[model samples]
Target: MLKILKYSFYEMIRSRWIFIYSGFYLIASMALLLLSNDISKVLISLTNIIIILTPLIGILFGTIYYYNSKEFIQLLMAQALSRWSIFTGMYLGLAAALCISILIGIGIPLIAYGVLGSAELSLFLLLITMACVLSIVFSLMAFLIALKFDDKVKGLSISIFVWLFFAIIYDGIFLLLLLGFKEYPLDKLTISMIVLNPIDLARILILMKLDMSAMMGYTGAVLSKFLGKNIGMIIISFSLLLWVILPLWTIRRVSMKKDF
Candidate 1:
């Protein structure tokens, strides 16, 4: 397992796409920070961009890499290695590569700019938490595409739809619910709805860190009520952790049964 993981990690680091992805993230992060006059606004804009773009790129790049590496994987399979080892190694390798890139591209810059110290610890925790969630989400997405779809185009198409649903459509549905049930206990309803969408949860978590949850109105109030209290924050954090775990478990089951 160690050998497989090591090889997989090194292989990913050597890839041109990984470099390109990291370069793009670094440039964007720096540009956003340097261009903005307000630190809070810069953080908000960068956070939103990272939450949306990171997962999309991660999923797309990972799926493409897996499909493109089919020949290499087949050769490894022929060496009598266990399927689980190969799959786990590949998944971990891809995830680790992206995680490292995120740290370098975003984390380092934020620290260098002294942005890290200005934000509350809860905000930093939220940023790290979101990064973890993005990693899991995209890793699972890559696994599903690799295991189920033989065609690269089809796999990519599926990933795009999945990203769109989580990042855009889910928010649209939440808005509709808000409009339809304005008279209800909207605060609780807003919290419930945010919990249903990982992206929204992520957005809320970061915004809360920025002390910008007030901008969300009733939904913000619920988030504030939940995150403002110590125990409630813990519960919300654990719920986010569960989001990371469940999808990976599903991917593990699917990979195990997959013919590939």
Candidate 2:
């Protein structure tokens, strides 16, 4: 498993797409920080980037890597390599590659700007943690989704659609529900809805650290009451942890039964 992980990680390090992803972050972070000269605003912009782009890239890269490694994986299996090791190694390898890209891409500019010594250091750590977690969560989903559909095109489409649903449609539907049932209480329902979408869960977690005036808003009140400050953050962190575990477990279970 460690050998498989090393091969996959080193292989992806040479991948052009990973370099491109990292470069994109490098250029964007530098521009945002240098141009705006405001760490707070740069962090906010970065949060949006991490929340949106990281998951998209994670899922796409995971699926493509899976298909690309079909022959290699088969060769490994022929040599009696365990299925879980192959899958887990590949997943961790890909996830690690992404984490490195993100860390280097954004870390350099942020540190150069002296984010480490600032009071916003914890917020910076939270942002990076969520970015890594989000990457892992989506990559696992992409792998499991790829396994479910042998057709590459369909697999890719479903992956994008799942991302779109969580990133966009889910929020739209949640808002409509609040508007449609404006007279009724939706405190608990709102919290339940956010849990169903990992993107929203991440946003809420980071926003808690930001402590914006918007935190005094309606949804914030609902979350505050239901999740109870510290407990809420713990639950969100635990939930993100669950998001990573469930899909990998599913992949292992399914791989055992299927002749991959």
Top candidate on TM-score is 2
As for model 2, its CA RMSD to the true structure in angstroms is 1.4
Listed in order, each prediction's TM-score against the native is 0.89, 0.96
Best by lDDT: 2
lDDT per model vs. reference = 0.76, 0.87
lDDT of 1 by residue, 1-260 (tens): 67888888999888888888778768877898789755567667768777888778877877887887787888888887887787778878888888888877777766677766674445655675587677667766777776788888888889888888888988898889888988777777777777767677788778777776677676667778887899877766677777667766776787677665
Deviation of model 1 at 201, angstroms: 1.2
RMSD of each: 2.3, 1.4
Model 1 ranges off by over 4 Å: 116-125
| Model 2 backbone overlap count | 0
Candidate 2 lDDT, tens digit per residue, 101-209? 9999999889989999998899999898888888888988999998888889999999999889888999999999999998998887888788867888888777767
